[model samples]
Target: MGKVWCVGISPTDPRLVGIEGVTFHSTVNGCDTLLVATNKNGLGGISALEDNVLIMHESLATATAKGLHRMVVLGDTSSLEGRRWKVHAESWDSTMGVSVNSIHGMGQLIVEVLARSAALKGMQVILIRVGLATERNINRHLARAFTHSSVRLESFKDSKIPDLDAWTAMCLDESGEFNSEISSEQWAPSRED
Candidate 1:
């Protein structure tokens, strides 16, 4: 089975902060350490590095086959204020009815897409820094669907510092599954198919 690291990012300003808010567990050194940001900007500040940037819309299976071990998820939590966060939370609860709903929804979608591309490859899907907004706002039905799937769901504590380089290194060392022999292929689905 392959490993997948789902890094969560606040939609603040990638320029201002790197990937700070993302979360995931480290499998290296046989220790389970949660990687989180120390600042609000999170890892968004260091997105220029190829290893640190991840397009959420991309298919997970294709990325995994191509040796993509780290995923940076840009969520909508950074844009909310105290009041707005509360409102969003209430709305999400009304919609999904649980905090893990959004994370589950994302996990299921990622798993389905990646599974189709790689024939349902075994993979671990880690949800990083899934705090307040999206945490409370996800659709429960979608989340429940994912919980019954095969993807692994792991969460980390929020960090105050947004360090992209450190997080990238951690992901590569921990969740990276492919070796040098693996080849990178385009995983986009064709409309005609």
Candidate 2:
């Protein structure tokens, strides 16, 4: 509902050639208006004195979380073009297919969801701290299943996610109760698990 100035990726990028108010820049800048799509790196360009709201996009998984394993999380990290994670025997024999590869970019999915919601509410700056705070608890529980308590979570951004989904899989057990048991299945192939 506001006069939103859409910026181009670059002047030569061709997205802003004839657009009335569009401008191009390497980084997000020149706005007293609310900020959106700024990531960790772009945070540097923000002015504290401005009344802008920052809608950032961060990955739920990054290269650090990449590797082979018995079962790889079907996400951006393990799916990078150069990466390859063969299915573990248990998962493969149980499920279908031979291997898993990445195609759809999943890295920034977390913030994208948040950003989309913010955009829906009208180009306002959306503040998201849930993924930021929930990371430790998630890493502590899931990673600890394979590695020690010191496997400090890297840039993986799903920290804001609630604990219910993974720990409390809705899949009913044989007796039709909520599955509340820890899985022995390794989620990712890691160096030390």
Best by lDDT: 1
Model 2: per-residue Cα lDDT over 1-193, one tens digit each: 1122222112343322332332333332332222122222332222421212222322111111321111101111211122222233221111221122322223234433444443333332222111112333333332232232123222121323322211211111222121222232323335743
- Give the Cα lDDT of each candidate: 0.26, 0.25
lDDT (Cα) of model 2? 0.25
Model 1 misplaced regions, further than 4 Å: 1-61, 77-121, 127-193
Residue-level lDDT for 153 in candidate 2: 20
Clash pairs for candidate 2: 59-107, 68-189, 70-88, 79-102, 130-160, 131-159, 131-160, 135-159
In model 1, the worst 10-residue window by lDDT is 178-187
Error of 1 at 113 (Å): 8.2
lDDT of 1: 0.26
